[model samples]
Target: MSQRPTQRCHDYVQEVFAQEDEILRTVRQQTAAHGMPQISLEPNEAKLLQLLVRLCSAERVIEVGALAGYSGICIARALPERGRLITIELSSLHADVARAHFKLAGLADKVTVRQGAGMEVLPTLAADGPYDLMFIDADKGNYANYLDWAAENLRLGGAVVADNAFWGGSIFNPQTDDDQAMVAFNRKLAAHPQFDSTIIEVGDGIALGVKTK
Candidate 1:
């Protein structure tokens, strides 16, 4: 028998720090059944997102990628009754799956699934205003562009949380376009003067930036 240390640690984290219920399990199954990519955040990362939402008192949230409503549901569950979450997806099929999951999770009212390229759709959301938190998990090539929008749209003290920041450890020596884009995104966030940021060593990696001015 082969024992994998990382797998063991992952199981331990799931057991002790990030337990998922039936709803989350069903969401995972649905996404897989629909042929969506298996790239949702880990259980611990999902819990961390919930905590961050609470920590920031986020009432208006935007998610750049809604693969199968897993992250959307995770963040929506953290909201107060009146809070709203707008999630954008590039694939209409994925959007449909996410909407169904949101309905099953009884978050249909709280979550709005928009199907379109994020850059094109984001501009239409400008009037939604000064969001409390923005979570970017879309195409890596556009991560920095998303940050640009967040910087302009999020209110002072609002947060921008980006997933897949490490690009599967490619930040050190990026070989592909996506990996190179992530490296650029990381550097841009770390050096930007208007926002205070840090990269959390979670799942892949999560870059968190708070607008200061």
Candidate 2:
């Protein structure tokens, strides 16, 4: 069967630049089997996150919105042996599954699954700051809030990376609440004085920002 252009390009990119291993495959399958949302992240996006972690030499990572530990595993895989990852998940079911996956991946010792609303849990993490990197992929409406927290808690040189910044191209539609929030978040991220930022077309869209102050 002929593949669509997008799929063809994606497949070629995966072939040339990305690799997905068995751990990630099992994580994906388990999410589906457990009736969790299949919005973990694209393979290339996961690889990009790993690359970003390495690029920043990140030792401590804070991940907001861990659906099933897929992305957390990706981040954890890039960390050094002694590095740590603290992920916030609202759903207890998701958190439980994520914990199991982390254990299966031998990352239970390095990863901490905090179950609660990201915004509520974020304040408690302040004492754990300043983190090396913060990855946001939670509720779209809280994008700005998450970025704000990242700006304050991340170290001066740390980076804040967010997924779904384009809101499925609905930023132009002007109808969805999520789209409106995303538009505001994108603008704020680029204009925020403490960070230099830009959004890239990866997976829906990814906002990358570095704390300059």
Strongest candidate by lDDT: 1
- Give every collision pair in model 1: none
Per-model lDDT: 0.93, 0.92
Q: lDDT by residue for model 1 over 1-213, one digit each (tens)? A: 896458778778889989989999999988889888988988988988989999899999999999999999999999999999999999999999999999999999999999999999999999979899999999999999999999999999999999998888998988999989999999999998879999997788889999998
Q: Report the Cα lDDT for residue 84, model 1.
A: 98
Name the runs in model 2 displaced over 4 angstroms: 1-7
**In terms of TM-score, how similar is model 1 to the real structure?**
0.95
**TM-score against truth, every candidate:** 0.95, 0.95
Off by over 4 Å in 1: 1-10
Model 2, CA-based lDDT:
0.92
lDDT (C-alpha) at residue 79 in model 2: 97
